[model samples]
Target: MRLISSSISLATAAALLSACATLPQGTSRDSTNTGLDVRTRYVGLTSDAEVAEILASPLGEEAAVRLALFNDHTLRARYDQLAITEADLRATGLLPVSDGARTPEAGIALPVLDIFLIPLRNKQGITIPERIEIEVTDHAVALIADVRRAWTRLAVAKQAHNLAKMSENIARAAEKVAVELADKGNLPADELVARKIAVANAEHAVIMAESERREAREDLAGLLGVDLMGDWFVHNADPATIPADLNAVDMQAVMDNSLALASSKAEVARVGASHGITDISSILPDIDLAVSAERDDHQWEVGPSIEMPVPVFNFDGPKREKAEADVRAAQYEYAHSLVVTANRAALLVRERDAAHKLVKLLNEQVTVAADQAVAASLRQYNAMQTGVFGLLAIRENAVEARRHQLQGWQRYRNAEVAVDAARAGVILPLKN
Candidate 1:
């Protein structure tokens, strides 16, 4: 009786889920003991008002990241979806044998052999939680990258547009000079007309550039999940580098944090448990116990009865083979993830370094050349050594050079963001 009671208690304890999962808030932030990626940090907002307040302020790169982490409805919905796993636990429906049979039974939680099965117990206890939390970290990494890249584009657009406006001023000045030369008959009719055409092109370019700037701001705002109509502002154009903490990059860290590997590992646990259940079902006999009390011609009888199913055909063979195959498949999937992650990490590192060098080269050399070009052109025009068109061309080239230089800086910053996300910290490695 004590043994049966203990078994009943065990089964009940394993299968109840009263609430859904949520992001850890407050002081428990990023607690690594749960097997989730340690680098994922989030702050949950209590209401739409808090999000509004953040949006009201000048949103910096880091602030934008924080808002997206907590404010995005799609992300929150994904976190809530983990609760669906609880439904699977409930599907057994307490297994209460309410029909009046010889065996009168009542138990805690419920007594279902499958729930109490060794394999299922292990999966419910460990693997499911690990898999869900892997997704938490995965989503966070992707969202943060989005914030960084969008913020960079917004900043670059504003800078580029301002640069374009400055170029227009130079074009306008060239047009004025052409007007003066034409009045004196020193400049040809075609040359003055060409100067007017140059001014017109520069003005059109500024308008297009401004339109792009607004669109970039809108995109950045949308990612932040602020009110669509609210005014947008950026606190930092350049995203700060997320420094790596490890003395050396460890592949193990990424593997531990990979969602894909976590899913496969969970599958392995589930199948291994299924394999155990099948093996037990084939080998062990099912014992049915019943007790009854009755008055038959003033005679009372109450005793326990036992019945078993004979093992005619062993059922574990095909199931065992299938479980073995599943295990092999999961192992191969894990191996593939590792290889892909390593290759990705190497590629991001190379591109980041190259991008950094390219941006530096543009800043150090191109800007200087552009300045000299403008100065020499101005000197030549004043000395009448070059025509108005020649002077305008030099100035136009300088402005275009500046535009490319700004774009190069934006690309370098974006590359750094990619590398940072790809690194995912040693605490949260890209899972192989």
Candidate 2:
């Protein structure tokens, strides 16, 4: 009788403990423990009014990322997955309730094996939420990279447009000089026409540059989840500088903070726990403690009863086999993630260094040679050793070199951004 009372007390204690247990919040802001690459400054933002306020000011890279993180509906939905996991976890703690009025005899049945399996079940329950949190972190990190890439594109577009406008002005000035030479009978008619053609080409380049700038602005606005109809302004900040040393990036930090690996590890833990629970339950018999009270022949009969099923017919072979298979699959997945992450980091670093070298070559050798050639051609034209056509050709070559240099700088900046993104455990797709 005392043992029956003890068993009933234990069951009551478990119910009370479940009622008191605190569950994780449903929102990513509270539930996500994995650190983001950028500090989430505006977490749990409630309204579009905050987005409007940020947009009303000059929008910077960080501000754009914050708005996207706050406003992305998909990311918020992913966070909401935790609520379902929490519900399942809560169900694990509650005992089955039976109708009390159906029978005059009443009993409380407790699964004795659950006392040993509950911890493993709870641990398995925890891994699912952890995996969800890691997935949320991955999405946030990827979104940050997308915002930064769009920001860089906008900055480079502005820069390229300004350069094109300046080149157009220089072309007009040269056309004026050719007009003067034509009036003095020193320049041929064809040479003057050539100068006009050069001016026309420069004007065309400016138009193209302006179109590209507008497109970049639209792309940025799309990523920010804001309509392009507003008077919101994006600040024309210079793109990030090329990284001087790829060696400075900490590979260990990449390994430690990788969202993909973390998620896989959580999966492994979940399945491993499941396998343990299944294996243990299969080997041991089901032992249930039942306390009953009954009235028979006008007398009260009360006692404690033990109900256990023998394992003669079924040893849970199918369940144990499935659990073991699941554990093996998870372990394999974790190993694959580990290898992929290491190789990806190495590849990004190599590509970044290569981009840096290309930019440096363009800046030092290509642009410098074009400038030197133009200077020599100008001196020759002044000394009557070369025609105005030769001078124009040299100047055009210099303009083309400058355009290439600008593109090279943009690519280098993007490469640097890619390395930074990979360090945060997300890879940005290669942009054309």
Candidate 3:
């Protein structure tokens, strides 16, 4: 009975000890940790009036800028790349191997027999993070360039929309005048039909302009991680004309200013130089304490951990060649981009100069046409030598002259925008 009670007590104690050992290792709650929720609110449906109000509000420009910041798929993808690189950086800091152990015990009454046990552990150094960092830095520079490119495109779209709006207004005025003359029978019915056709054409222009504006807005919104259909307006100052003087710009100098290509070359050279070095370390044996009835024995052992690659079969020959080729390719691309940009700038400058000259000539023509039409109308009206048809014809000529002048101005503005974009390496403001 006493032996049975002792066995039961020992079992109960062992069960309690096992339960304690099986408990979780850490506390469930921590003061510094907080749950994160990434839900975003979308803008509600808005009317034209509401859109106008939103545009007037300060939030509209904020939203526009935010859209530029967030909605870009390229920029967003870069962010993900940055995250992946960061994780790789963390992983690189960790050692490649870790320690582990196991133990076993048994009761026996045999003599002249013994059991042996083995323990194992491993340690190695990691050095790939440094290389990863260099690559990631290069990627960051490229991301900045992408952002600038997207912003320039958005600005261009807005300017185009403004030009289209001005054209629409001119078309509307012409249509109104044509309708009035036709109603009075001073103009042929076909003239009014032509005017209606012009109205339809002008409406189509407006639609196209709106479509472009929406596309730009959506692109910017996507970059910002915002809803593309959100009510927002861009408030920018009127675009400035390109300067008349571009003779001082050296095309060759601009072409040599590529930092990305330079960085890539430098990194490829550095990594190639370090490719042969391998990480190696050694581990000191550990001491274990034990209690025994008579005495205790201690043993020590030493081991080396080597992490060198065997160059007999693979010496990174292929990888080094690839890196050298990449450097050459990057240099070529940088040179090419510079040449293309400079040539485009030169062409745009010439085009702008021609457009300015044309606009000047058209302005003078409009003035002369206006005077001639007015003089003709006054003479006919004073002498009663012409009917309403003659007067209406003179008026229509003046209106047409004005329309031509508007068109010349629009063309000149567009040419100027192109010049500005080329010169500044970015998009210019809209010419309202």
| Candidate that would win on lDDT | 2
- Regions of candidate 1 where Cα sits further than 4 Å from its true position: 1-57, 78-128, 236-252, 276-321, 372-394, 425-432
* lDDT (Cα) of model 1: 0.54
TM-score of each: 0.61, 0.60, 0.40
> For candidate 1, lDDT tens digit of each residue in 1-432?
111111100011122111123223212223212322111122434566777787788777766776775666666665445433333333344222223211111211232211112221222222234445445445655666777788888877887888889889988988898899899999899989988998899899899999988898888878877766677577644322323221233334433333454454455445545555333223222221235566768988554322222223335688656655655564455445545555666666666666666666666688779889889989998999997677877877888887887777677667666655544421122211
Q: List the residue pairs that clash in candidate 2.
A: none
Q: What local lDDT score does residue 144 receive in model 1, on the 0 to 100 scale?
A: 69
The digit string of per-residue lDDT tens for model 2 on 290-407 reads 3477787999866433222222223368875675566556655765666677667767777777777877777778988999999999999999999766686687778778777767
Clashing pairs in 3: 67-220, 70-223, 70-224, 71-222, 71-223, 71-224, 72-223
Order of quality (lDDT): 2, 1, 3
**lDDT for each residue of candidate 3 in 183-224, tens digit (9 for 90 to 100):** 888778887887778668867977886786677666655554
Please tell me which predicted candidate would have the highest TM-score against the true structure. Answer: 1
Provide C-alpha RMSD values for all models, in order.
Answer: 19.5, 19.6, 26.6
